[model samples]
Target: MSDIRPGGPVFAPEEVETPPKEVSKSSKPASLWTDAWRDLRRRPIFIASCCIIAVLVVMAIWPSLFSSIDPFNARTCELATARQLPSAGHPFGRDNLGCDLYARTIYGAANSLVIGISTSVFAAIIGGLLGLIAGFFGGATDTVASRITEIFFAIPSILGALLIGSTFRGSGLGIWLVVISLTLLGWPMTFRIMRAAVITAKSQDFVIAARALGAGSARIMFRHLLPNALAPVIVVATINLGGFIAAEAALSYLGVGVQPPEISWGLMIADAQRRFLEAPLPLIFPAVFLSVTVLAFIMLGDAVRDALDPKLR
Candidate 1:
């Protein structure tokens, strides 16, 4: 092709001018939480789990919103309606004691969640601190702390709870007993996680830089190491929260957890287990609630774990 503008002085290719290429701007990389949240927003599993958890949380916080029946009131129990199946007025039907099974299930959510969450918090704090201290120091302190952790880890949670419950025979141990047992048994896992994380983080360039900058040990540990070391702990705690709830149910069923007067899914199952042949709804309703709740948490934890770990993502 020729530049046809009649024979005006045609410019050679070498003399022609061209536009310059545009330079691209660089942006800062997203932080861990930002990236995790972005990934979580796009995943249907995360969304579904979060929605399920939100409804359960609301039910736990305000049972009246979902169910008008008061399970706590002894007067509400009708001998005539005992062991009844799902009906028009009562969707979940009546328990062995004739109390509305739906109402009791609703109320039980709060207790189970409390036990699980509180135990997780307590265990994480206690274990995380000990781990931080041991990992940061990495000497005799590490050896002693590690030995202690190992000792505690050796004791199975259920067995320990049973031992403690038997020691107090006849004297009822309330919610606190279960909380204490779970916390005691659960911390070792958190301790191991935090300790490993801190060990890895303490040797990183950021930690060395902080130390070189004259930051104190306490400052370096809490301000630097702890934050970096929290990812694994958070993941473990989220999963453990669900385990604790299931454990609480198991313990209560075995007569070692929250006793009479306190309502829990485990206790409900225990109550209905004896006569489950006569009426299965009482056992099934609470069992279903517990299973669904545990599943939701586990799902949430798995989603979080995948988001946090780039390899998994």
Candidate 2:
């Protein structure tokens, strides 16, 4: 046998033809997204919810892609297509003004989603900050914030939104009014949740350690406590999204939401109410869309809750 030269790419005694490392058949590699996707796929409700939401989102963003007619346009009498039943030309049939109902519904879905998403973001930011403040700092600060939240909570959300919407009607403040009203009432719940989380976190060893290490109050609260407390806040925010959508619809139905010349699912339902016996498609289509949107959000939230649950992991 020839002797291998020193430092000449010589293999160690144990390196020649080393057996491949054995991968256990029973144990699998771990991946965060893969595990989450597997868990989500196993739940039929979650899959269905995701599909429904995806379809709605697509419709909302690209109504023209799905339909030829302009959703906002009022078709002329020459079209002569008003009240036509669902068929090859008009699957969802025509509305009172001969405009394509399918096109309008798609636009309406988009409008509702916009309002819902916008309002939720506003509420989350305002409420989350207030909650963090109240929860992190106890004593007079907590008491004052708690009282303010209680006052807002005492008033029904719809009634409050109605008051704001009606007041700002025709002043080009349609959607903004609704968003501000909802945010005002929405922050209370988040505040309460944050307070509890802060109280619990303040007593933790890590927080105490940070404080002893010369971390400022703001640093301790924001850097250490807030991040850990965000799990519950996110879960609550997800569930609240459905509520926000439904609330917008309810406001519109009552003539206190998105005003005329602007389409919303609630407004569509309201318009459909008068002609229910004559042409039910207008009412039915929007109702179906609204219901599906709300249900999808709820299901998605539940799926997220399960996915985030430490016990399940």
Candidate 3:
């Protein structure tokens, strides 16, 4: 201590005590939904499809929100406005009964979407459950279920729907009949896919490990295998939605689906067929809606398939 100099530190200047520099935490990556939204925003087709679907859904839910004209009231006639082309007031023109075509089309879209969506959901649920069971539990159960699916698949879906609809004899029953018929036939494809998936998954290391861990058969099948196998099923279901809608339209066109007073695109097309030369708006509008709806669903399904597929990613 007595020999210490002014420029020298006793222990290297006490190491100049300094705090460690703080490091900022890297920002967490965006979530899956955020990424999906960002991707969807970049797709013009998807954006347009979403917008069209939104408008249709809104029209279906709130028919009175856009217009005050009674859709059912056919007597309110402007004699001077009968069969007029698209104008400021009547955007879609008038129909045979001198009713506002735009209002009718809006209501019709609502009805069609309701029936189509309901039928698709019902069919998908029924078919998907059956498929899961048949595929998971092999042997006689699988054979019987497969045979039944084959029988229904051999029969034309529309014809089957018609026969069942005729047998039911009521509007509500008709809808149910169509759903049941479609489901009966629809299960075959799902069953084939699920069976293959189950077979493949059963041999996976995870499945073998689950069995080694004393997991029950049902637990292994449902908890472990099913979730992993659902990607393809989801894609199929999405694509099937469009098919169900088209099926409903076809049935309605044949006069076996949606009954009178219930506006259906198919029925609209059928009615407009007779007046093609006189007024093409009826046919053109409904056809356009149907075509666009189907295309949107197809595109959405493709996007989902690509997104969910690991190989694609």
Candidate 4:
């Protein structure tokens, strides 16, 4: 179809009925968490990690669910029963102490998982709050927060844990003391991540609009900024969960963590170290469990990180 005339008004080029641009189902606006959850669902690693984590959670909650044998049962110490290799009845074999290695290994997960989750929650809350305040206010607030974070960062996480753990070793607050030590040093990394996220988020249009609407600082921070800033902190916390677990184990191995009668994988490792050649089952079982648990948390964190990051998409 030709226009009316080049010299004349030229009828609009036959108003091309460009079909209204079809709106994609995916184009509907969604919150960051909504998009992240959708992305997370599609990731195999996320699914696997979630499943493993769920199982670990169950194991942590109820060790009895996995085994009928009592962890407190003393070994017969008979030449046949003592340090027996893996058998149908005792898959993880008997330790030198005559305790069933399998039972101890399963029970150990409870302590490690509890400490990991507890420390992560404590760190995230403390760090995230400080970060929100610093990032939103900037200036002197930020300087103070950043300086404190730097001070903590300058101290190695493990060394700080060791020192604190050593100080409180004989107090009998074994697990709690270890958790406290980890929390003391753990918050800085989470704070740094959250601060960066908040800084980036605060400058966005929504925050500006919230400010324009005269929303109070607390309201804006809690309602608007916190949701956005929390994503990165969550990722950091998840990854650090594994680190905390490992740290607990390391401290336990060094004889400063969970004390006697409160079995931990690290304690099991320490107990088995003397007789590793004579009976490796005690050492191997706990080490394997610890490794799997740590790896699961790390994998979960990595998957979450990838899912949340727009650049990864």
Among these predicted structures, which one has the highest lDDT? Answer: 1
Q: CA lDDT of each candidate?
A: 0.90, 0.81, 0.73, 0.87
For candidate 1, the per-residue lDDT at 266 reads: 93
lDDT of 2 by residue, 231-299 (tens): 667767777888998998899899888777888889988888888899899889989989889889988
TM-score of every model versus the real structure: 0.90, 0.84, 0.81, 0.89
Clash pairs, model 2 backbone: 135-195
Q: Candidate 1 — worst ten consecutive residues by lDDT sum?
A: 165-174
The TM-score of predicted model 3 comes to 0.81
CA displacement after TM-score superposition, residue 174 of candidate 2 (Å): 2.4
The 10-residue segment of model 4 with minimum total lDDT is 72-81
Which is the winner by lDDT between candidate 1 and candidate 3? 1
Candidate 3's C-alpha runs over 4 A off are 1-44, 77-82, 171-174
Please estimate how well model 3 matches the true structure, expressed as its whole-model Cα lDDT. 0.73
**RMSD in order of candidates:** 5.0, 7.9, 6.0, 3.7
